[model samples]
Target: MLRLAWLFVAAWVVPALAAPPDDPLRSPAWPYMAERYFAGQTVRFDAAVRVLMPGAAEDPLAVPVYVDAGALADVREILVFADLNPITTILRYEPGELARPSIGFRFKVQQATPLRAAARTGDGVWHLGGAWLNAGGGGCTTPSQASGSGLWKDRFGEIDARLWPRADGLRRLRLQLIHPMDTGLAGGIPAFYLETLALQDSDGRTLARLQTFEPVAENPLLSFDLRGRGAVSIRGRDTQANRFAGTVAP
Candidate 1:
């Protein structure tokens, strides 16, 4: 009887392993991305953390992306990447205690690839959400539009930002800066972009930090949630050792 039960278990498991995966999005790049990004964590494609991108990127240079992991609680870190891009990482965010899991930004897409966001909770599990994007390619390989137009040259390191109070006492911050953010994939162009940014309060206490990467859209864009309505400053640096500092008041 024991032998028969073992055989029954094996029969059920073998076919299940042989069958195709039941991933909701059925992402073709999940296997490779899993090994590259999350090798040992429990991961599943969950709709609760929405990763919204257009079906087709009309402009590969600047494709808008929205990641809303607001439904999840105690999110430790969030990672945004493209599976097939030359430079995969777009943003690595830590919500910490003040901010929400939702963000709106733009990025570069090399070609048709899977745009993914993985949110890790306190439980040590990474929740994944993504969708395939269709593109004609060349977002990474071309010179930045801002750079080509020479606007970023005159306005380099200029940080323009706004902070607004919400009905619930939270604050919303939208920031833009002028930078080439070159990926270096394009011929003769060296990579130069904001490497790190920290959001801070009046006392210089760090609210949160964001790790920006090469694939992030040129003329860097960022949206963040502030827990308090107090004055906050955005401080950052680029690859060339240039410093950026700006204060936004309520």
Candidate 2:
């Protein structure tokens, strides 16, 4: 009876294992798309870096993505991209000496696509990680309802930051910035959003730098990993050439 039960389990499991993946975003066509975007650059599949996102996006306009490269040492920068979005390249992040090679942010998913994170270490190898997110559509083309009349008249560029201790002895810093992040896709709205952000310590030592694009959602929210506990500050510049700065306490 036990032998028959074992055979029964294998009968069902073998065919399932042999079946092709259901999501088109995870299909073979993604590699061709990635190659086109990289433009002859080498990308190696490495498990050291991980991209985390929901299997299916609940909200196409505000999908959360996390890239964790803590297992990799001496990482210089991490580049995030979505294969099927109108704007493929998401953000480029350069981590400082005391900063961890990890970042979390909310972004717009144009459709079902493979989201990738490439971490370039000191040795010059681009280690890649990816995740597939399924969405209905219209993440970029639709106008944001949050950007109503006079909504950002006085509250633009405001930042709120906080630090929370993690279980692994690493600190997580969360930051929220007020910005329109207009993609210029909506009628009559020109592109107006934060383009650059720098994180530094109280003594002015740079921690991390971020180059962002219009795909980021309205009122951008970001999170980073810190090695130790201390006060930190952030400075940013928008496409309009306006600058803003704020500090976070321990």
Candidate 3:
């Protein structure tokens, strides 16, 4: 009958329309990134490398994220990325021999997306952790703190480093840098930030390196674990090719 034919068509069409589309975050793009970054190796889910952030970001421009890999030893590097941001890779940090395996920093969230952290071990395995952050939007394209009148004129290109003693016989190294970190999405603001950072010992041996992108918040705060050290020094350069350095003794 005509009624039976219509019902059959409706059933087929409804299911097709209702079926959810593939998640773009895990599509071909993710595989390509995995191949490039991890050399196509499998990333295992790990609870030790914890990615802690708020369920909902109150301030998308300055959302705080803490990556704790303190329990894991022999950590070579840590990488952080956002699934929905225009620039997917946010930060790449290489911890030093005596440096602690924990870091805390702030970043911009464009929208609701998965923020992932990968901790690479000495054996070349990457342990992954992720969390979702719901943002109200406009975190990337909005005006920055440096865009304000006269804010960046005198305060730019400054570095501060400090070392503190820990109960575990390790030292905690904290570094802060003054930079605008403009994302270029905002009107008339070119992308500018510290692109590379390195820590070294008194003998000029490199300890660890860091690579950062525009998603980093203005005036980045970085912490690292440090072992025995007489004097530790840091050197870095920004997008404008401005070099800065600082030293700390514990």
Give the candidate number with the greatest lDDT. 1
Work out the TM-score per prediction: 0.87, 0.84, 0.82
* Clashing pairs for predicted structure model 2, backbone only: none
How would you encode candidate 3's per-residue C-alpha lDDT over 1-250 as one tens digit per residue?
Answer: 9999999999999756543333333543554455556664547668788889999999989898989887787999999998778777899998877566678889988888888888999988888777778899888888788788586768787888888888988777888898888898998888888899998878777777889899988888887777776888889999899998888887
Query: Which ranges in model 3 have alpha carbons more than 4 Å from their true place?
Result: 1-36
Summed backbone clashes in each candidate are 0, 0, 5
Candidate 2 per-residue lDDT over residues 1-250, each given as its tens digit: 9999999999999866544223333655565555565444555678788999899889888898999998998999999988778877789999988789999998887888888888999988778888878899787777766567577768878898898888988788999998888877778878777899998877778889999988887788999998755788889999999998998997
Ranking by lDDT: 1, 2, 3
Which TM-score value belongs to model 3? 0.82
What range of 10 consecutive residues in model 2 has the weakest lDDT sum? Answer: 18-27
Give the better candidate number (1 or 2) by TM-score: 1
Q: Which residue pairs collide, candidate 1?
A: none
Compared with the true structure, all predictions reach lDDT values of: 0.85, 0.83, 0.81
Query: Following a full C-alpha superposition, what root-mean-square deviation does model 3 have from the true structure?
Result: 8.2
State model 3's lDDT: 0.81
